[model samples]
Target: MPEQTPERTGQPVPEPTSNQVPRLVVTWLVVTVPLAYGLFQTIKSVVPLFTG
Candidate 1:
Protein backbone atom coordinates (compact mmCIF):
# COMPACT_ATOMS: atom_id res chain seq x y z
CA MET A 1 0.00 0.00 0.00
CA PRO A 2 1.14 3.55 -0.75
CA GLU A 3 1.69 5.81 2.22
CA GLN A 4 -1.10 8.30 2.62
CA THR A 5 -0.25 11.99 2.56
CA PRO A 6 -2.31 14.36 4.61
CA GLU A 7 -3.82 15.84 1.46
CA ARG A 8 -5.02 12.49 0.24
CA THR A 9 -6.11 11.58 3.75
CA GLY A 10 -8.15 14.76 3.94
CA GLN A 11 -6.73 15.52 7.35
CA PRO A 12 -5.69 19.02 8.36
CA VAL A 13 -2.04 19.77 8.89
CA PRO A 14 -1.29 19.26 12.49
CA GLU A 15 -0.64 22.22 14.73
CA PRO A 16 2.10 22.32 17.30
CA THR A 17 0.86 20.78 20.52
CA SER A 18 0.34 22.91 23.60
CA ASN A 19 3.15 20.99 25.28
CA GLN A 20 5.54 22.39 22.68
CA VAL A 21 4.79 26.06 23.40
CA PRO A 22 6.86 26.40 26.52
CA ARG A 23 9.76 24.47 25.04
CA LEU A 24 9.67 26.65 21.92
CA VAL A 25 9.46 29.82 24.02
CA VAL A 26 12.40 28.71 26.13
CA THR A 27 14.39 27.77 23.07
CA TRP A 28 13.64 31.11 21.42
CA LEU A 29 14.55 33.02 24.54
CA VAL A 30 17.73 31.03 24.97
CA VAL A 31 18.87 32.00 21.50
CA THR A 32 17.48 35.54 21.40
CA VAL A 33 18.30 36.78 24.90
CA PRO A 34 22.02 36.35 24.49
CA LEU A 35 21.82 37.83 21.00
CA ALA A 36 19.82 40.78 22.33
CA TYR A 37 22.29 41.29 25.15
CA GLY A 38 25.21 41.15 22.75
CA LEU A 39 23.58 43.63 20.41
CA PHE A 40 22.72 45.98 23.27
CA GLN A 41 26.24 45.79 24.64
CA THR A 42 27.73 46.44 21.19
CA ILE A 43 25.52 49.47 20.68
CA LYS A 44 26.28 50.73 24.17
CA SER A 45 30.01 50.42 23.57
CA VAL A 46 29.82 52.00 20.11
CA VAL A 47 27.72 54.95 21.27
CA PRO A 48 30.44 56.07 23.66
CA LEU A 49 32.94 56.04 20.78
CA PHE A 50 30.71 58.27 18.64
CA THR A 51 29.65 60.59 21.46
CA GLY A 52 33.20 61.06 22.77
Candidate 2:
Protein backbone atom coordinates (compact mmCIF):
# COMPACT_ATOMS: atom_id res chain seq x y z
CA MET A 1 0.00 0.00 0.00
CA PRO A 2 1.14 3.54 -0.63
CA GLU A 3 2.26 5.52 2.38
CA GLN A 4 -0.01 8.17 3.74
CA THR A 5 1.62 11.31 5.15
CA PRO A 6 0.36 14.01 7.54
CA GLU A 7 -2.78 14.19 5.45
CA ARG A 8 -3.75 10.85 6.85
CA THR A 9 -2.96 12.11 10.35
CA GLY A 10 -6.26 13.99 10.40
CA GLN A 11 -4.78 17.49 10.20
CA PRO A 12 -6.42 20.08 7.96
CA VAL A 13 -4.68 20.69 4.68
CA PRO A 14 -2.54 23.81 4.45
CA GLU A 15 -3.61 26.79 2.38
CA PRO A 16 -1.95 27.36 -0.96
CA THR A 17 1.17 29.51 -1.08
CA SER A 18 1.69 32.92 -2.70
CA ASN A 19 2.88 31.27 -5.90
CA GLN A 20 -0.62 29.88 -6.39
CA VAL A 21 -2.29 33.30 -6.52
CA PRO A 22 -1.67 33.86 -10.22
CA ARG A 23 -3.15 30.49 -11.11
CA LEU A 24 -6.26 31.24 -9.06
CA VAL A 25 -6.55 34.71 -10.61
CA VAL A 26 -6.32 33.25 -14.08
CA THR A 27 -9.00 30.71 -13.28
CA TRP A 28 -11.28 33.40 -11.91
CA LEU A 29 -10.78 35.59 -14.97
CA VAL A 30 -11.50 32.70 -17.30
CA VAL A 31 -14.83 32.02 -15.58
CA THR A 32 -15.91 35.61 -14.92
CA VAL A 33 -15.12 37.16 -18.30
CA PRO A 34 -17.64 35.10 -20.23
CA LEU A 35 -20.17 35.40 -17.40
CA ALA A 36 -19.92 39.18 -17.36
CA TYR A 37 -20.19 39.37 -21.14
CA GLY A 38 -23.37 37.29 -21.10
CA LEU A 39 -24.90 39.41 -18.35
CA PHE A 40 -24.13 42.60 -20.25
CA GLN A 41 -25.80 41.23 -23.38
CA THR A 42 -28.86 40.18 -21.38
CA ILE A 43 -29.19 43.61 -19.79
CA LYS A 44 -28.74 45.34 -23.11
CA SER A 45 -31.56 43.29 -24.63
CA VAL A 46 -33.89 44.03 -21.71
CA VAL A 47 -33.12 47.72 -21.35
CA PRO A 48 -34.10 48.96 -24.81
CA LEU A 49 -37.84 48.25 -24.44
CA PHE A 50 -37.98 50.17 -21.13
CA THR A 51 -36.22 53.19 -22.62
CA GLY A 52 -38.10 53.27 -25.94
Give residue 3's lDDT in candidate 2 (0 to 100).
70
Q: Show model 1 residue runs off by greater than 4 Å.
A: 1-16
Alpha carbon lDDT at 27, candidate 2:
96
**Whole-model Cα lDDT of every candidate shown, in order:** 0.92, 0.90
Error of 2 at 4 (Å): 16
Best by lDDT: 1
Instruction: Give candidate 2's whole-model lDDT.
Output: 0.90
Q: Clashes in each model (backbone N, CA, C under 3 Å)?
A: 0, 0
Q: Give the TM-score of candidate 1.
A: 0.60
Residue 39 displacement (Å), model 2:
0.5
**CA RMSD for every model?**
6.0, 5.9
Task: List residue ranges in candidate 2 displaced over 4 A.
Answer: 1-16
Return the TM-score for candidate 2, rounded to 2 decimals.
0.62
Summarize candidate 1's per-residue lDDT along 1-52 as a digit string, tens digits: 9789777799997776997999999999999999999999999989978889
Per-residue lDDT for 13-34 in model 2, tens only?
7777986899999999999999
